[model samples]
Target: MKGFSMYIGGISIKNKIFISNILIIVVFISTQSYFANTISQKAIIEKEINNSSRELVLIQNNLQTLVSTIEDYSKILASDYRLQNELYNDLLLNTKHEDSKPVGGLNNLSMKKTLSETISNIVEPNTKIKAVSILTSNHHWVDVGFADNAYASRIFGDGYGPEDRYYLPVWTSLIKFGFLYEGEDSVFAVSKTVIHKDTGKMIGRIFLYVKETTIASIYEEGENKGGDFYIVDSAGRIISSQNKAKLYRDFKEAVSISLPETGKDTTFTQGSGSEEMLIFTHRFEPLKWTIVSAIPMKNISSGRKEINQLILGVGAACLLLALIVSFLLSRSITRHIFQLAKTMRQIRSGQMQVRSPYQSKDEIGYLSEGFNNLMDRMEALMAENVEKQRTKAEIEFKLLQSQVKPHFLYNTVETIISLIKLGLGKQAIQAAQYMANFYKISLSKGDDIIPIGEEMRLTESYLEIQQLRYVEYMEYTMEIDHDIMSYSIPKLTLQPIVENAIYHGLKLKKEKGIIRISGRRNGNQLEIEIYDNGAGMHKNQIKAIMDGTSVPDEINGFGIRSVSNRIRMLYGERYGLQVESEYGVYTKIIVVLPLRYH
Candidate 1:
């Protein structure tokens, strides 16, 4: 232990901390897995046992009720005097009818019709009774139910005799040994002897047929995945089961499970070697049947096996989680050192703007602050020289469109003259004042880039001045977001677009027109849109303006290509103007600039 402690002390502090945490986590996970597996095994087995016992009790009650109901119905038919007389008259009286065919003298057909109605009335109300038949002492029989008459006659053709169970005085308990007609499967039967009250002689037998599924259906309410359910009689013969192939087979295991009539539930593990099964036996005394549920041990233990796998998975995930937590712990301590190294490399490559914003009072923070001061002094010296060169280049770019500015001023002066001549002296003064404000902001000490707020104020002045001359022909609105007012953009960017929209487009249309100016910030760029509802240009005219080949109209001074060129020169090629127009519909011009403050 002393040697291990000395080795950890030799390593860095971050590595020591990471290793210590990993060892603690590994020991905790191992202990948790051991106890969780032991407890899960016991809980799963108890749950399975309880679920099986509940299912067995539920099926037992349902079978007992079904058997009792069928027995009661059979006894009811046996005591009906009208039904007994119908069978007797049909057998004893026969004569010649008007058609010369042999018939009964006492209206035997009427009695047979009455018997048929009684059977329908009795069987229709019960969904379980598949068929009902009356067999006489002389082998003459009639059946009135769902079973085919020919099939029923062939099955019970042998009439009542000493060998038949129906000859006894009492109703027979449900028995599995019976001759089921073709197409009738997994069935059991019960019968009662119909005896004449006056003479104490056997009249006929009342046989009620029911499918064994009537009981198995109750057991099938829940899906029993692990085993097969069997309904077996006291003779150890399987009566009905979910697996139809096992019917009538001898289930010696079921009979031998609860011998000596203990009258209690029995559950045990049966079979040998790896091919073992778990057997559960339950007895129903009224029907003398045993319900055996046999599930292979391999099948029942599958749930326990899944729980074991889940525990192993959790252990592995915890180990991986420990490694991840250790890695993050080490990284947190070294983050500032790595960032300081990267900033020094950037400064070596002559990037002065890459300053570290870290301001801690530690040694690394002092180093970062010293590096930032050195870069700030260097940047101030370089910006003064760079600003002079940029201003000169901008002056050269603006001279290309200088002629348009004088022409615009000339048109505005002529509009004020027209307003005064129309006897609107008050409106003339407002137009002149708006024109002066527009030009004052336009010059802006010859700086090419100005605040967005000042540019927007200039556009409002220009539009209002134009509206005075074309008051009935045009309307205008301005929507500017307050957030982007401090961003810097090129000067006189919007006034040229708005002037063209009013004079060339809206004036050409006979209807009054609408002009809208809107500004908003989109990510790293600012979007200023000039939209107009006027006589828009055709596809060819828009292409010519974008290509800088369109001839300027007499009234319109500035061209769209000039504005697109100046913006692309100030920013990169990514920033420029986009034009969209459809003939006789509308026109929109979008000016894009980088989001920067002067």
Candidate 2:
């Protein structure tokens, strides 16, 4: 019985191990299949979304093309009308000889009577006859046959008045299509030339009369497609439309539609309730009118529903597959999870030395490297933050110190002005004025840059005061180009260099020293030079200043350093002030800046 019990226990243990191995194999195969399917479905969905976006863009382009074509057509029509009218008037003016022909008794009377009757019929029946005249080159009325003659009678009648004589030069210069009078009812006219059969010269003028109805007809014809089409005047008033009740209406509502300021075709929708519509306005360049076509939004988007439904059906199927695959794949994708978990756990426990293992060269590997990089960046950022805080505090202290020096100088100048006023009158006034100018520039509302002209003026004021103290010890000349005077430059950039040249370079010199200040344009750069033939520095000092390694003993190298820093900040390190000096001969400071024009 003991041997049999041992055998059964051994078999049961073997069976349990076999079942566990098979279950592991099955789970692995299923997870792999799910991940493959999920990736495939996602690709299809992304492709479809991209295609839909492209289609929408194409539709917008098509609409813009249609709007542009219509606007071009309107412009051509307006140009053609103007050109034809000018040609007709030129023909009539050149044919003054035909007016001298004598008329037979009955033939002339019958023809004149018929012409008068035709004109009266065309004019508005309610309006009375003002006058009628046939113009000659001599500026006299040849005949006034009757109240009803031809199309010309309506225009020449009482509404025109006797002062409305068509002067030859003025008539020839009139535009083709425009309102000639400002009354309740406007008149539009088109000119035509009537030539003699034998001579082939223009003997008469035929003016085509256009009443309010003519414009109304045009608007009605254009608005037949169920969208509102109106003829707007240059001032944005609706002159004619299918809806006569809305005639002469102010188009402020439509004109208020926001459009891109760039002169291009644009569309916008506005208004509400029954008035809501999508308006497409294109500028008619020749007529100076904005031809607007408004269509209901519903009309444009109605057909889109069917296409959207088709997209929806395809999208729904894709989404269902994605969800099923995503669920199974989430369990299978353990590579990224394992790496992330290891790194995170190390980070949580305050281990900055943690790094992700470079396992597979795929997205997972990239993610691991990215995490390590992020950690390195965080450490660097903390160190940089501390350094930045220290630097900012230093800069604030320097700025405060610089501010106090200017105020103190201003106060001292003011005291000197009072003393000079009591003793020396002329010197007092000059000193006070120079002092005012110097303080104005020094304070400058804390502006970093001032115009080149202003800076030159400021430097002159400073030099004026310095010359009084030095008394012909130094002579300075400034030569600046007129074109570069308006360019912006850092304030006090030239003055400090001039001061350094005067005090450090020229102070101990026995003979008179010459300081030259000049500016010139070099390609896209402006070069300013301050050179003095005074006591110059050694090579070692020049190197120290350029490298920013050593500070000057007398003055805190703060002024030169400030100018250099400002140039670097405004332009870049590539542009700044350079110092070059030769021992006991000359010292030159050159400032380089980008050429800017206002």
Candidate 3:
């Protein structure tokens, strides 16, 4: 403290200030450089981890090819004609005619000699496979023979019932075949019980050795292959590896395979310090093996730490801090602007109730309050406009429906007057009563919706009056399906169509015109058909009626198109009326509507 005081006293005040500024800048630069180096190392490690995953997939493919090669060879050896014939003769055919003289067939010893030659020819070429052991239920050999009927079947695999001849060739597990490859470094043995091709018997077995070094060639592509690769069985045993020392070792630590969130394969990291490894794994389900690529975390970051990058990082940090301070100084003004922008966005998205909650006596505050007041006015106006639209729709629907009623009323009233003039007093009263019931269903307690059953009754009542008026020939039948009797439809829906059929259709026909009304469910809608053997319209007349354009006065007066329009308005555009007619042959008015029950 005394030496520092003397040095400070020696220098001027201006020199002390300049020295302090230099010291501050040096300290800031040094601290920023250390942090920058850490960040860069982490980034490098992340990139390397991604590269390791792609490399792991390549390793998995190579190992799979090796496993597949072993499988293909096994299939070839199992189906060889000479090998199968010799084994079958020794095991099955030779046992039956042991001493019998058949000129083409060989005795057991001669059959064994031929089998050994056949097996050696298949096994010798593939250096990856070290040996072959052929055994039969009646005869057994790694090559030399011993006859034991059920011994070969039970000895190869576990869970073998007396009748079971199948042996699963699970790699890296069998100890019975260990004696066959005594001096050899065997990775696994591919074994399968050979079934007799002709008799369906467990005739023989195929046991072959796959050398351990063959697995090393799968992942170790060249001398410079970077990853430490290995195969781990389900028991945590290291089945095969590039390192010979790790082979057959209990590698319990390598068994913790998991699925990471970011990667595609079943890759997981294990342990934490020097033992920490980024272990990328792929499960080869065909061979029942888990292939792994273990990479050290330290190796990922093994590179020169460049201090030149530190200078650039420190400069960037200083600029960023300056910007942050400037933003903080102006945040009070910008925060309100941001709030106003957010409020306008909410309003634009149809949330009209949202308002800028910031309050102040500045110009911006007045603007925000004005925006909120404008939104309130807009919301109120929208409600009023929606109400007006609903009222207009209801009035239009009532008008379309009321048009049907007046036309029918005029026709019925004229029938009553004509009946009175004809002196049919009782018929006039009955026709008047039917008209009253028809209007009762039409009113439907001041509502437009009525059951389809009631609509049928309305059609019937109108027809009854028409039948009385034209007692000579007018006839009708309601053939509606009972299932849809409870479905609901608009009031006065069917009556207008039936009225149109009578006035324009059946009246013009010379034949006894019959109107058949049939209703059935069509997909999600109810279809009601009004078929009349009457004077049917041509294509142009049907088009005008369907287009809701001008029609012949007799047909147009009933407004069948208006019924279709009412249906579309109530149920949407898909539900309406359709007309199918052939001139002077038939007229079919089909009404399509949504199936509603109330």
Candidate 4:
């Protein structure tokens, strides 16, 4: 089983599904075929039986109409005063001529002729009647036959039963021709008693024989097809049948089957030997008779065999269809999967631009699009990393340059010497001490970031040294927020801007210029503002400086631009320097940085 599973797994999905569905289709066809024969056999038998019952119902209706008409004939004969007087006169004549009875020979021919003519007038009009006869209370009788040699005496004799009771009509069970005649057979009839309408007294009994062939005609189709048909009374006595031997036989004795209590249509099997037959029975409630059909088991089995073969043929066609559909659906799904897998393999092998070409709005299509988007983001990040590296190196070189610039050292040394030559030892010592403090904080042990307090101290020392050098020409003020003194900022960030203010703005002014430096914390940001009341430059000059287009001419020392770039590089573009100035009024440089405590 394990090996078989591996074999199936190795095959393409289309073939696997085709194979699996073949098995399923086989099972389905097998199950359907079994049930089709098992269930449909019973269903077909029931439907055929019900169909036979409907045909029998039509025959029953015809029989009822014939019987009802016969009853009407009896009423007509009883109500006719002329006919009643003739019957009474015949009774009197027969009593007087008792020796002239027509028993062994034809006696009283004239009387018989007159009475036969009278009965013929009524029974001859009805085509369904084979013979009609009357028996008076005094035992005088006469009969007329519609068919040749139809012996009314043989068909119905003096034997009187409940069916022949006075003033009531009833149908009799089948009986044979009383006196064997050529071409004569058994027959049944509807009989009633005739009465004098005015006196309401029973006169005599009268009977009408209906040809047995009429009952046989009801099931002519079944008989032609070699099947037996029967009409039985409610007592289960066969009243009429195609088979003369079956007529008058008890139903249970002939077929060994019991009728249902509801008298509905039913089918059953009877007999075990060659007599075995499929019997279908339907009861006609109006006639209180059950119509039955019997077909041999051999005949019924032959038809069932044909039906089974047809069902098998249809099942085979459905199985083939399922196979084709399964193969087509599996192929569509696996084709998309294969394309995605191939594209993923290419991507794994460093072909980042490769993509699956599935454009359908399905799950596979979504996965393909997601894969392509992921590649795009990866490529963008790679380029951004390279750019960041280049910018970092440029900022480092500028910081190195600022730390070792020679003119800054030379100017500070000359300022201290001039002060020393004036014999102002204390001021000279203070100037030297301030320069020492500024360099110590600016270097910050080679670290680029320092506390806000130390950065401010560095700027203050440089301003004090510059003030001593320009005494009357330079004035400075510092307004530092003590709360933000511990916040971290880029080292030497403020000192460069201050130096630019003095060299570019304050130094060029004629009157003593004021340079104010203030640091404070604003929301999530730390801001240091440098304002100079000097000869401020125009917007064009500030733009050129910010854009790195202006060349530094020894005194500017790349200080402002370097500080702006370093602030942006370290804390992102949102934290940087903004310059605001007016020509000859005031120049304000605000350095913004993210607030971070050391």
Most accurate candidate by lDDT: 1
- TM-score of each prediction: 0.43, 0.36, 0.41, 0.44
Clashes of each: 0, 8, 0, 0
The TM-score that candidate 4 achieves is: 0.44
Q: How high is the lDDT of residue 45 in model 4?
A: 66
Candidate 2 Cα errors over 4 Å, as ranges: 1-423
Q: Which stretches in model 4 have alpha-carbon errors above 4 Å?
A: 1-15, 28-53, 77-83, 94-110, 122-125, 140-165, 178-183, 197-203, 221-228, 261-288, 293-315, 321-598
The Cα RMSD of model 1 versus the native structure comes to 26.1
Whichever of 3 and 4 has more TM-score, that candidate is 4
lDDT: worst 10-residue window of model 2: 167-176
Tally clashing residue pairs in candidate 3: 0
Candidates ranked, most accurate by lDDT first:
1, 4, 3, 2
Which candidate leads the pack in TM-score? Answer: 4
Residues 57-92 of candidate 3 have per-residue lDDT tens digits of 777777677667766776677777777776676665
Give the TM-score comparing model 2 with the true structure, all chains together: 0.36
